[model samples]
Target: MRYSKATDYALHTMMFLAAATPRTTIGVQQLAERQHVSPTYLSKILTKLVKAGMIESTTGVNGGYRLKRDWENISFLDIIHAIEGSASLFDCSLDHGPECLIQRVVTAAEEKMETYLREQKLADLAKELNLMH
Candidate 1:
């Protein structure tokens, strides 16, 4: 039911990228400093995001990370899946048939949450943040 700090960091990092809507790259050290986290630790998480195609990593002295897609198309679920994977949060270890009522209930709940997240675009929130600042 709970997501890891990695997911938390990824969501925040994504929000930052979406809000800034920067064309230039943002250094990992700068991102880490802003979050008060270790650059090394954040790099690992960023790698997952890169693999997910949500962001790109640039190389060289001015190299860093930047959003690869339009922020308006990015959803909360996308960033969450990049860090948490799309695997079902609840898996019944016991050998239960497809008729398992508990499994059905949990699956329905998960689907509802997923739908909400999928529809909630990060760009909308970022725009609101911009207004606040």
Candidate 2:
């Protein structure tokens, strides 16, 4: 399955947060502008993140949202799970609906892909993105 724009926006937003000062709140408006995403949609994405305990939000002057935990500890799979839920590609067996012989091959391939993604940490992505030198 393809990733939704929500996931892209979430990862971009999280990368910025990871690079920013810790414990410092970042306004949604500014974050949206920086990430080149609409504030309305970004707000929804941020809400999901906050609910997942990945971020903390505060209202009032000099307040916005901040990461609840260290970026190094956050994984790409964690973000994917938070936004997309525990969804899987090969959720069904081909043989369950039809007499297909590709079920095992499809399942094995899907598992390998999932494992690779699960091993990829958000920190790894951030480092890749920050590579300018």
Candidate 3:
């Protein structure tokens, strides 16, 4: 399984917010510049993140966006799920096509991966990132 660039950016964005001081807003342009992503590209990801309640936004001067919850309260899986929806790893259609040998293996792997991701909170990821403001 692979994640789209959108998912990668969303995850990176959340980690940035988590690493920032709580309740402080960061502009999308600033975020994009730091992450080396296009502002227009980041905006699309931010919109979805905000709509999902993972992030909050404001307008006008001194306005930008902030995390909706504490970093410890969020999860990597939550961000992934918010951006990509459910952790559906297998396409049943593949099994329907022909004799698939690894369907069962793939299903088990997906389940294991999902469980690992769910158990891993964003805070856990931050610890690994060591992202200090």
Candidate 4:
């Protein structure tokens, strides 16, 4: 299942933060430039992440954003849910009837997808990409 562009940016932002020096704060503009996303759009995404307690934000000369928790503690599903709210791979409308077999299958698939995401941590991703030092 394809996630929204905002979710994609959020993932990239988190990974970038995770790969950087621990506790090093980065501005949204810098993050946007690195991710090739619009600063305005990235700012909104960062807001949601901050609200979710995934990232911390500060204002002032040395203020910016940083990961609020350890990379090992943050999972793909966490980032997904933080941005998308409920990581449902498929939207099943009950209009097809309450007992639709297809709905059951889709729900099962979504569960599996979520489980896989939950097992994937940001650290793992960084290591896979050789971004971790």
Candidate 5:
């Protein structure tokens, strides 16, 4: 299952946010520059992250975005769900209903993926980034 570009961008952006120092904010322009995307596009992704409670947005001369206090507890699944809304990548369009074997197989795979994602915390990578900086 393929995720959208927005999800990819959000994940990378979040890692950067997670790596940042406490209370320090990164502007959308700067965040977008790394991905070679426009600031306006990244702003929408930031808004989703803010609404998901993974980050906070500030307004003023130093206005930007920063990770929340509980960012260390946020998992990859959390960030993905924030951008993708928990929708399944594949859906059986036939009339087989819930008893479809294909559906069962797909569901099982999705569950396995979800478990792996849920176990991986964003803080894990951020800690490494912090050490390197």
Candidate 6:
């Protein structure tokens, strides 16, 4: 299973925010430059994050974006869900068929991955990356 490009950007963006000073707001253009992503694309991702309640945004001269919750409160799964809606790695579309062996295996793997991601917080990831002080 693979995550979408938007999911990758969301994860990176969240990590960047987590590494920044608490309550610090960053402009999309600046963040895009630092992350080597297009501002237009990043802006769309940021909007999804805001709508998901994962990040907050403002307008005007001092306007920018900031994490809505502490990094410790955010998880990889949270970011995944915010961007991809669901973290299920399997598309199990065989509801009518008799039991599919592959479906069982995929479901188990998806569950395991979901558990792992839920246990991993953004703060812990930042610390591992040495982005936390």
In each prediction, how many residue pairs overlap at the backbone (N, C-alpha, C within less than 3 A)? 0, 0, 0, 0, 0, 0
What is candidate 6's lDDT per residue for 1-133, written digit by digit as tens? Answer: 6789999999988888877754789998888998899999999999999998889998988888998755578889999998998845666676643377888777877888899999999888877777435
lDDT accuracy of residue 130 in candidate 1: 93
Candidate 1 per-residue C-alpha lDDT over 1-133 given as tens digits, one digit per residue, 9 for 90 to 100: 8999999999999888877764658999989998999999999999998998888999999999998856578899999998998999888778495688888889899999999999988888888899999
Instruction: Give lDDT for model 3.
Output: 0.81
Deviation from native of the Cα of residue 52 in model 1, angstroms: 0.6
Per-residue lDDT of candidate 2, residues 1-133 (tens digit): 6888898888778878876754679999999999788889899999999988888999998778888866577777788778988755664533464345476667677678777877887676667766843
TM-score of 4: 0.87
The sequence of per-residue lDDT tens digits that candidate 4 reaches over residues 23-70 is 789998899999888899999999999998888999999888998755
Q: Give the C-alpha miss distance for residue 12 in model 4, angstroms.
A: 0.4
In order, candidate lDDTs are 0.89, 0.79, 0.81, 0.85, 0.89, 0.84
Q: Which stretches of candidate 6 lie over 4 Å from their true place?
A: 93-98, 131-133
Best-matching candidate per lDDT: 5
- In candidate 6, where is summed lDDT lowest over 10 consecutive residues? 89-98
**TM-score versus the correct structure, for each prediction:** 0.93, 0.81, 0.83, 0.87, 0.93, 0.87
User: What is the Cα-based lDDT of residue 8 in candidate 3?
Assistant: 95
For candidate 4, the 10 contiguous residues with the lowest summed lDDT are 87-96
Candidate 4 backbone collisions, by pair: none
Q: Record all residue pairs in model 5 with backbone atoms less than 3 Å apart, i.e. clashing.
A: none
Q: Local error of candidate 5 at 129, Å?
A: 3.0
RMSD, one per candidate, in order: 1.2, 2.7, 2.9, 2.1, 1.3, 2.2
Error of 3 at 11 (Å): 1.0
lDDT of 6: 0.84
Task: Please give, for residues 27-94, the per-residue lDDT of candidate 3 as tens digits.
Answer: 98899998899999999899988888888999989888898765577777778887898856677775
